[model samples]
Target: MNDELRLKIEEYLGGIMSTSEATLFEQEMARNSELKEEVILQKQINHHLRDDKLNAEIPENEYTRRIRTYVKSDEAAHIKQVLKGVEKDYKERVKKPRRKNLMVAAILIGALLLSGIGYWYTSQATPQELYASYYSTNDLPSVIQRGDKDSKLAKGAVAFQENNFELALNYFSEYIESTSELDPFVYIYIGVINMEQGNIASANMALDNAIDSNTLDSSRGLWFKALTYLKAGDTENAGLFLKKLVESTTNFNYSKAKDLLEKL
Candidate 1:
């Protein structure tokens, strides 16, 4: 847990560094999902595990009550007899239809409950997957909208990263004109390149599009939008965008948004 590496990753995420640096950081991040998840979780825990944050400030009696809350209900202690082998041992007519129905119903109920819980757990995935799922789920307007233009946006991102802002701007503009299905992130990066090159109007437009463009889900996409707005000095919209991201797993953005909110 070197502070230097931590800061380096954060800076890379903020788009202030070179692509080679970011690629290295991303390679490390992608080496293991658990390691990357742990990295984010540590950042979150460091922010929230503060003296004044939660447990430390609670009264002894309240804390004791919180502990008691985990005690199981009476139903958890109560045991139910399971008819495990009854179904297999009997033919349809050998057992009463009523008995068969009850067993089948119970098994289905258990399965449904288990499936529901599993689905809920899956839905609570990390934000990056959330964004990816969001992108993939939309079907991307299947028309291709225009031929070969999508690749130009990708090229634009690379050019922008290389600081060829004018060339990046042209590619982005061409890509933008070709299709409406562009990933919102491209708009952010394209806008940022424009911003850095002092094309305030286009920069504002690009970031605004990133913020306003339709997407399948609201992961930290709102965070990107908020950052773009902030960079554009549109604090009003930025604050509003950040407000929607408060309860998400996007704690890095949540804390950053809190800072922006305070300043506003």
Candidate 2:
């Protein structure tokens, strides 16, 4: 408010005031606290306004104009300096978008890798191929042993699968030559294979061998014999063999035989 006090405050702020000015200001502060308070406020305003990073966005020309305004009005400088923090120079905040982009790209790549591996696994394995890879599905090993392709019994099974009755009969007959141990089911399978190839008479003969095993025929073997008879259009013989399975208390195949008989 006074010329002397204003000049004294300016000199003190510029670091050119005498040491006596500090003592005088302390005494003056007790007498006129308002002026001392105003001087203290001016110093705080000058500190923040002088900081460049605090107002990085103030254009060069505008900053020079603001500096001139501050040199003239201490009170206006305080208001403008406080506003410096309000318009924060936020170039560092731009990095947030880049971080989000990287995160999305990482997720996309992970999903693609998982999908590719899944597709590759399925493409290399088919259901039938998986089945053929195994030697057996039931508890028994394969009917044909490893590297037993030359065996007559093995040949019969292959020919039967191919629906070649004439060739299957020859191989099966040869298998029977050394095997009193052969299960009657083997004969029943040959008969069924024969019927599939349209050899009704040979099918009947093969099935006859299954039923006349002379020893205890498997209820399963007898069931297949009945099935063979049904295929040959001899329902009477089919029903007879089927009754064997139906009547056997311990026959696991009895349920299937009864189901088949009901359908017949």
CA-only RMSD, every prediction: 28.4, 36.2
Tens digits of per-residue lDDT, candidate 2, 84-125, equal 744553334344668655655565465445444533442243
TM-score for predicted model 1 compared with the true structure? 0.35
lDDT per model vs. reference: 0.55, 0.60
Candidate 1 on 217-263: residue-level lDDT in tens? Answer: 33335655555455555555655555555434343356655544444
Report the C-alpha displacement of residue 116, candidate 2, in angstroms: 64
Best by lDDT: 2
For candidate 1, the per-residue lDDT at 63 reads 67
Q: How far is candidate 1 from the true structure (C-alpha RMSD, Å)?
A: 28.4
